[model samples]
Target: MPSNRKYPSLELDVSADHRPRIRLLLREGIIAVQLLVIASWLAVHLVLDERIATLGAWGPLLMMVALFTIQTRTNSDNVWRYSGLLFMLTVVLGFKLIFLEYPLLHRQFSLAMTVLAVVGASLLIRGPMDYLLVAVLSWVLVMPHIGHDDVSDYRWYLAIFFAFSISLGWINSRTYLRALSITLQIEQHYRTLSETDYLTSLYNRRALMDRFERFIESHGGGFFMMIDIDDFKRINDQLGHAAGDQVLRVLAARLRNMAGSHCAGRLGGEEFGVIIDTLSPAIALAIAERLLEAVRNSREAPARFTFSAGLVPFSHDQALADILIHADRCLYKAKRAGKDRVHFGVGEHLS
Candidate 1:
């Protein structure tokens, strides 16, 4: 059947609108890494010289706590989450610069870890604007230190690493967006296959019932119809099963066209169901008559054939099973009286 399924629009930039679980995992991973860095720094200082480790370490630790708290409570789209990460990074770099006095190698190792954290955070933020903001801010934070005698000799290496980190983060983000788009397409394809009938290209029984239930819940009432081809077995026996299939397919197309926006589906064998969202019984009956006329005049069928239909007005207060049973009874009556006519349940008075 033709699908009315809506899909997400694919864009060039990566955002939190796709694959939320993956974004959550990446956020958690960044937080965990920051916590590891803080713990390791505290442990090393405690071993070498407990005096230097003092209350200064608390600044970075507290910043990490605030970052984690923001991540847990807010979504990626929140400005507070991005601001918190930048604030935490500033606190960490500032703390290292002012409070800690370590060797050149140790300082380089710490800066490299900070760069990694920035790259991870970049993945969680939206688009190029946020990414550029992060890249510039990180570079500015480390710029003053580039001239310092402690690590001035390795400035070129630091610059290269920064460039590489930015490139890597952008590439990863684009790759993630592409993968998410493909995943969504595959999911939509499979869902369409599951809901559609193979032969007649109409919604299957399960899909039709689900649509009927949803319509009842939303619109409060509609007309439910059960239609069956007259003497379908005779057509199959005389004209062969291939001709029977063609008749079914042609009739389904006519029904779908006549029903317009209403839900129409194959209910197995020669029986089909339609749900029309309308308050007027006359309008529903007119549509049913048109379908019967269309099937009767169709040249695609092996020979002239007619169908019987039963239509019932459904309300929110009525059970779906009861409505189907009532419609089926009306259909049975139509077949018994004579085929090629419309039968309607009680409450609909026609002249």
Candidate 2:
């Protein structure tokens, strides 16, 4: 006796960013095929045959219309479920072709089968279970006359069509998956290049600003700081630019460790920027002093390098240019008074 245990259906895992795009393409393609079938059937029956729509054809057309409508909905979790049901219904309608008196009507159902198979194969990213579903759907397209001795020709034609369709569907699914994978890799590569600094592997100035805008929008208020390495040019002059770069990298790593959930970026030329979560000058100063201590203690930097920072709190209504200007003034003050210290300017002073 055969075992009763059933294996679970396989699901294709896609990146969150790509899933919606693939689903949209699949929806559009499937809808276009459905509309094409409906239009072609109308032309054939109305123009050539001079007959009205039959109940047999109407059932599947209505089903396809309903499925298309459902697929058009936003944020559907189980689009595949609805689409699979629609294809199954199409296969059932394929069986009706065999009982028709006219052999020409058989070709109509075959067109529908070919369209569905091609659409499913090209647009859907799937695994073994999805392939199994397509295979079953293809088999059903040829299932109508398995026992019919009279219509051997129809069975043979459909069998060949089924074989061709299944093969094409498999090829199409593989091609789609490969293309999607390549596209995602290219996107990721470009995204990383755009957002990351070349030397320190931290976020670049532009990326940080973009993130700052979003952070300000969401959190309403935060603290921004500008960090400048003291005597940075001397390091380049004494030890060379390579050692300077190494210093920047080490400083970046230390800043990242201390930044916590806050954003940090290389703001060009031995200067970095950080956005701290708190708006309080006292708390923010404490955090900055701790960072200063960490960098002072770390042996990764050559010749006991130190940095000066200027911090200012920013509210939602404050313009970014004004905030940076105030922060820059405070930074200049710190550098002028003495290097290697944290300075704070009141946020309301500039605004």
Candidate 3:
């Protein structure tokens, strides 16, 4: 049976290609934030004398160490990342409430810390569920203290600040996602252009070979059919290049229809390749003959044309160069025997 599997598109390939870079950026951002936190801790120690015993002084440092360990030791697993962020948030809020004596300083520090937490959460967390959870938790932790002391005067102000910070973080996160989506799309477009033949809209030589290499590696064995248009240059000489181009395009469409787009590619001008995922050479040859007849009978072409194909079965152990050489030799034999025929590497001939 013919395998229903198809080649992956450039979009998917581009996403996979960009994943490591995205992870690296996230890792770097986390490390930078860790350094900033250490700097803040030093600055706080210089200015403030009142401390909540040793726990207040050391709690944040311990949390930072834990977070650093998580970030460095793991592959940025979301569970660990979110757990670290939540742990840091709890420690920051708990320490700020306890250490700062002045109600106003408490209020200011609490709001600033919560805002920073939200912004950080936005960067680390992709979905709003985790982000919203962080925001809501910060609000809950900070709300009871809003009415406790002289800070009561600015209760409304603090509420507004919380709302504003959450909104800002959400917007920032959405913008980041939108920009990332656009970047991936653009990269996929360029990648597709690079991999595709401009004329036939089929995989170009390099891309085709890449696909062939991957197929052989995965499937272990298959058949390769190399096709060349008979007297293709004569079309350009007699009817002009435009007509020749039209004929080529029509033939490409026929080949794609017969062999499946993922299985077919244009190797270069007037030549194409198809990978057959069948075990039997007889089935592979049948497919090649069908393609020949399809191109011959195609009504869309500006001029009628036929193709010669060299079909060779390959095993996973066989190098692509060797397979190509054998197929090309068979193709040369078919051309010598006379054009518009199929030649098999196993000494079979069909016209």
Query: What is the lDDT ranking, best to worst?
Result: 3, 1, 2
The CA lDDT of each predicted structure is 0.71, 0.70, 0.73
Candidate 1: clashing pairs of residues: none
For model 2, how does the per-residue alpha-carbon lDDT over 155-223 read when each residue is reduced to its tens digit?
Answer: 676667666767777777777766765565556557767788888878898988888888888887989
Which is the better candidate, 2 or 3, if ranked by TM-score?
A: 2
Per-residue lDDT for 149-177 in model 3, tens only?
Answer: 56556767767878888898899867775
- The TM-score of candidate 2 is 0.75
Per-residue error for 120 in candidate 3, Å, reads: 2.0
lDDT of 1 by residue, 1-351 (tens): 456544444544334444454455556655665566567656755664744555555655666566656665566555445754564465447545542455453444556655665576455554556666666576566542333466555778767777887788777756765675566566656777788888887899999899888888888787988999999999999999999998898888887787544878999999999987788888887888888788888888778889998989888877788888888988988999888998888574322
* Highest lDDT scorer: 3
Per-residue lDDT for 180 in model 2? Answer: 61
True lDDT of residue 148, candidate 2: 47
lDDT of 2 at 118: 49
Q: Kindly report which residue pairs in candidate 2 clash with one another.
A: none
